[model samples]
Target: MSGSRKYVRHLSTLVTFSVATLVVAACAPTSAPSGAVAQNNHTDSVLTVGLPGSLSTLDVAHEAGILNYYVAQVSSEGLLGVDTEGKIVPALAEKWKTTDGRTWVFTLREGAKFQDGTQVTTDDVLFSLDIARDPERSPSTAVYWAEGTQVEKTGEREITITLPEPSVNFDWTVTASGGLWITSRAFYEAAQSYGSSSDLIMGTGPYRAVEFQADSHATFERVDTWWGKTNEKAPKKIEFDFFSDESTRLLAQQSGKLDISLQIPASQQPQYEALSNTQVTTVTDRSYVGLTFDTAVAPFDDIHVRRAIAYAVDRNSIVSSVLNGKGEVATSIESPEQLGSHIGVESARSLIAQNLADIQTASFDMEAARAELAQSVVPQGFSAELLYPTSIPELGTAALAIAENLKSLGIELTVTGKPVEQWITTLGTGEYGLSYMSYTPTTGDPAEITGWLLGESNPARYSQSDVRQLITEQAGEVDDAARATKILEATKIALNDVIYSPIWWGKNTTAFASRVLHPEINSYFFMSGWASQIGLTDSQN
Candidate 1:
């Protein structure tokens, strides 16, 4: 989430949400399928994943961002990968040795071959890194390398990266989903094109870019001569069908056309499940959905006001209707699944136990919310336009619900929905007072959500300096135990600050035809993370 500094700590947090377990029991384990016809033969088969947003471009290097993550993976390899359990795994690099907190030596796997048949060399690693660490070439979120960076090939299989200051998350940072990627030093420098067209995108991964159609679609094909066989679940081919509307996407899934789609109409889960040849894969994720108040402004600067709006707002109905009871409504950014081991399944159990009575859950109490609203300077009938991004239907409902809730609290709120691009531009410029959005921590590490989302200088203009300092100290700590303690401590401190009314933690939802694979069931929909680990049954068609 930090704009600067790449890489994330290989984190391992326990999750106890029963959503995955329940979905599997309801859908799979049936005696079904016959041969490759009944069972899915992912081997050499083409699999396509759907994207809700439009793809801006295929220029992986210059247009690197989350919306472009799936595209980047087709052409590059990260030094490391964050596994399903949040543990860091070796990818392009075999392993790394940390001399101090500032320097790292990575040992590459010998004979690692690129798509072009060139053996991966230390120079290639260095060359690719030099680009990522360079502002002129890399699209890395952080520009920290401008401070002081020493990158060199120390040996045939060894590379060293030295930083000026301690970047506790540096080792993991370089491998942030879009940060670490391998490019041939020779081809990288000589190549005039980036990922603009399929011809320009190349990588050592099992699949390589073959077709790119801008916003319409993109296709990938298996590298028959790929070097790694360990990735058994890797698809032989992948095609992404882009659709801005949720209805068309869901229709594609029902028609047995799309192999998988992330946007399953929450209300249509049952209809899809009833299909004899359909399997819906749902997972638990470290995603959050909450109301962000402009803490930097007055009226909302008071924690009581934030709490009043939260208490008045009924999140349960929204969860049941909008999320189809598939999500865990968040009482805070940190959900029970993320902290379930430490306590129970309540959203704010670890953060605000003593203040539980004051903070409302998904359920709303109009009376209590109104009393707090009276304390505010809101004129007898103060009303403001609540901005909602029309790109996401959930935000629209959220805006509507929020507006209705505030009215009960004596603060009339008008809901106005707009496209994401317009909403972002207006929100950033402070034209919109309040809006709805989701938070997905780049790193599943607890500090990620708490540190960035609640910190001051947040694009939302919510600044709490005291909370921000705690986040910094915790992030800077190198020790494992100390970092954990600091993270939890910070969580408690920030949530109790009541800067914003935490609503619900977002859920990772996806619909797969019953005949497809149920790979790794988890809350990370975007990653569908364990797709490679999944063994699919044959498609009924």
Candidate 2:
């Protein structure tokens, strides 16, 4: 949510809060065909997962929504994968080793074949990686982390990757991004359309695409011969039914139609928890929502003006009131779970602590905000527009709070709401005065956030030569301690510049009927490895 991927909003029909109480009739789960037998010794033949956002594309190359990544992970696979514990595990590649910082060797698992029955080859790996790195075809979000990486097939089962320069956590970069999903070149070349639910995407994952209806639902049948199979119960078929309306999704959950539901509303969490046959799982994530300042704009150009807004907004209050205490105060873009964010050596810890201290010590003082505003060029204070997506209720609440806070400092703030697409377009233009945005650290590495701030289209048009140099140096450095020091140093500079007004770190809440079991959900954006482990209890009611 924090890096380049933040701009990729879930495209859906905007549902207003006024209509949230009107629940659409819940749809019952469709029955599996008679031939669809339970796979991997599971009792249930189908797993019904309800999604609040619609899947934009099945093509991994052009996937934008975060849920689409989960669909890709279950239907396709990468050379590597992140497990629920946040460790890098084998997917397509059974094991890998690196002799030097620049070169890495990977060995594919034997007998592993795509859903289409074609044996996965070294050529497929190279083809997928090459396409991912091609900037013209894919967004920079997918390939920027692997900019100068080159791949060569050494043998039938082995491939070697050579980096232009050493990258500290290169494996993580590939596992976290979407475009790295290994696809069957033969099938893709012959197919009329890529990423369509209708198109058969041949992947080496646990599930195979059986049926796809655009913006409606997608059904996937389990592969009995999948290499990653475990003794745990595996759903024979997984169906992702898209219900953009939150009320409809909640109704589906309450009516026993949905096996799993994600992003449960804070207000409705208690209602679900009180139910006898339901369980809620929540995990604190690296994603943070913040107000970004566009420095190209007049008032935002002044450091004092930026710092004043940072001090004026109470992050803790937002977390408690707007988020219903479902989040934590975010001190910086890089969360504590990410590497180089107080997770390493003493020096790195000290640097991260300093940034947290800066955030903590700042208070919401009206007098202080007025003092800072007086020092700015526009002492009389000017009218400003605050933009945010109308779809997210918390964002609107935060914006209204910020507007009130700015008013106390003699700044007239005008809050405006736009659809996700329109809001993202305005953010990219760098023409906005003030706006709220978010970043979820997809890569467990901190460099993703630092490197993204330096991107041309970043909402915060902050350009400091020292910070940029440090980011570049840390990006290719293989030594963890060295990279941590550089990354933390850059973080301090960015915090001092007040590029982003830190808000709150959110927790991903997933709800499941009491019957749903064994699904391995992780902290990453995409809930990888979910399909193979989920199962239904004998008592479906």
Candidate 3:
């Protein structure tokens, strides 16, 4: 993945909050009773969903936002797919294996056909991979395919891929999360604009796009000829209505106008939970929200200054007061869910805890912060500005809290909110001293974010030879435990440097009507044809 833009596009709208008072009023709800279901006694064959943001395009290649992936996955699929548990599973490819980490062999699923009734040829897979790896066509995903990598068809139903170097987690590159969506060569070549409303793309998934109006709505229908087994009781039609405003989505859901609402803000969780016909599900998604410093710049360039800011911010209070206790205070750059991809969740947590036990983290100590600042190049505190995305108001709230804390150390921290697009550009161009950083992993590999944060091309412009060396060693380390240890080692160094101050790992909220029954819901649920996995509840049926 491109260190600058790949993961940035997946920044979710799940944590929007305007004020701390609102969060306090919307206290966390008690656990729901077992077997609880929505009580809206309505039967409908269409599943209408409201998305918090508008889709600019259905083109996964050109615009691969999280929402775009959710819609595109309905009809398009990659060689691999991520299950609800965040494990890689077979999609276009029925099975795959590799004798050496560099070379992989895959067997295509037999008799799989696209929605157009044409067989999913090996040529289609090869073409899709080519597009995915082409820098011009897919700049965000091209990094997954190293230079000099090769792909060829070995048989009618088999293909082989050879990477320039060994990669233990290369399989993640072929999954939807990695941005490789397969489409027939003929269809792509014939279309004037692939994935456009007039020429929407096609794939072998359970549903086919029937209509799409940019920034308005997109409609899809179930494909009876789908090769994979689908829920017989699943809705016949899925309609996605875009609502850029969060309140509109809540209103739509409350008015019985929507069956599902994606990206429900954490502040509104209590309101959604109060709905008798709705169920609100929140999961700790694979996302990291933090404070990032341009280490190459002055003041922040001083490790003592960086460490002081880290110690000043109260992460626990931010998560509870500003985030409504929906998220957990982050301990490292990578989320526990991302690290747990190799080891179990508990094991990942234990590994992080064990490694960070001796290391000093920014634990909200004003006295420690002042002492560190006193030892910096500027013994007296300095002024700096922190940029946050205006769309996510909670980030602004967190920034204000941090700024207030910094005041105790004689630091004047200015908090400013910018449009998300401009904020991203400012961060990328190194135009700001301090900024709020958010990232959602594009791949399940634990090394994904770590490599970006510590590697040579890290956005922070901070580099350490030891950390870079460990990152390189872990990329090709086939042993899961060993690779994890290497990553943890790198994480320890980064934390010690305080280039990035960990804030909170985010939680994603989704509201489902009582009539809908989903098999599973998690960070990875939208990576595949999730709509096909949902059906009407037994009571509604």
Candidate 4:
């Protein structure tokens, strides 16, 4: 790991589903707006966004979906905010530094106030961080910021954090998600209620929530007294209307009722591009769609069995048919493009190319796969079930392909498709033998995702002491050279272990009406919380 290249930590983890398990009603929309209005047609200053699902909650601690984060980003300010380039930027904290590797100090900005007009102070920061760190209080945040950490008010506008151990990701965790969003202690204690139907959440953000209707809709109005930059006509109001169906969301965009729409299926991208009034922004996310083998299970417990499946699956064919050639065949579980890892895509490719000469042009070697399977405990493969969620068609399709390939190897693979909720429950309880999963990078550091896979609670029940130690060391190793070395060692071990087989890295697409002009749109931090920067164009471009 050299300082010359950014060491990227992609939060894009093994799961792409909204972390929130909010159940959405199945009732279809009764009506939709008319066809797209002309680009020059100036309507009200409201920006109607077609959300893929209803928001679960306004409270960051309660929900992990990007939709809720969208609301939180507008309605609250964290100690830090993620810029479009995936860089951590100052939000409430104007500057932060560390005197010792285990301790950090943050200086708050002057004159910052919450949406309710309450002044933000060091006490509020302490309160918010404490809750975020407590497992019983905020499960979503506890994973990012470890519990038992100490916080002290060092000055009127400064606070200090003392970690039990040196953690390079401490600041990244604070800035990674809305969970670190600073909230008024007075308001939370008095209200004792947040993320309800009434949408009574307060923060020091650029917008304030005015209306929230569960999974139906939520609306926010710009904060006139916001401490951030804004324009009078630049989306004075932003409304998120949940449309669970992709077709309905597409219709909303085409009908001009939606100024922005997210997570549009890739198969429909061509149709959307043909529309004259829509502008689509896309990136091949660091997220990977793959299969996780439960190492605790009999067959997968054998490394030979795992390697057999990896060799049998035709990743190129899946990318071509399922992903429509919009993805890259994953060479490793971690996205090759992670810059924060110091060894970026170019470096990764060069290294992989050098180490594995045949990787550059490899094909499915069924014979090789069969040989590996023969080395397993069961030379004659046994029947097993492979699970996938119906929400992502690509996963199911790829699983089907893998099933077909496995059949030739004397393996009776049963592919099971479940709805998002049931699938999540099944995974949580370890009810399946094999699974096709997705991973999304949530932070600028690779350790977040890498460390998670190696964590004790990993659903796959896969662990190797040597690899685990390497990943654990890389987590707190601030020295770039040492961290990179540890990451490489762990990655090599993981590759050899073959605990999981990666298929492809999918592209994330966001479509907006032609009139919208967003200067920088990124896959990181996703499409949430852009109301303050979204501007309007006089003509379609």
Q: Write the per-residue lDDT of candidate 3 for residues 327-418, one digit (tens) a residue.
A: 88889877788788878678888888888766565588888888989999988788988876554567778889989999888899888876
Candidate 3 ranges with C-alpha deviation above 4 Å = 1-10, 13-43, 190-193, 297-299, 371-391, 407-427, 537-541
lDDT of 3 at 160: 91
Q: Pick the candidate with the highest lDDT.
A: 3
lDDT for model 3, please.
0.73
RMSD of 1: 6.8
**How many pairs in model 3 have backbone atoms within 3 A of each other, for residues 3 or more apart or on separate chains, i.e. clashes?**
1
- Tens digit of per-residue lDDT, candidate 1, span 55-122: 44554344433445544554456676555444456677777867556787887777778777788777
Number of the top TM-score candidate:
3
Give the TM-score ranking, best first.
3, 4, 2, 1
Per residue, candidate 2 scores C-alpha lDDT tens digits across 391-431 of 35567778889889888778899888764434545654577
Each prediction's Cα lDDT score? 0.54, 0.63, 0.73, 0.63
Error of 3 at 528 (Å): 3.6
> Which 10 residues in a row give candidate 1 its minimum summed lDDT?
10-19
Q: Candidate 1: lDDT over CA atoms?
A: 0.54
Q: Model 3 misses residue 273 by how many Å?
A: 0.6
Better model by lDDT: candidate 2 vs candidate 3: 3
Off by over 4 Å in 2: 1-44, 176-179, 191-193, 197-200, 211-214, 230-232, 340-351, 359-362, 377-391, 410-427, 431-433, 454-459, 476-482, 519-526, 539-541
State candidate 1's TM-score: 0.77
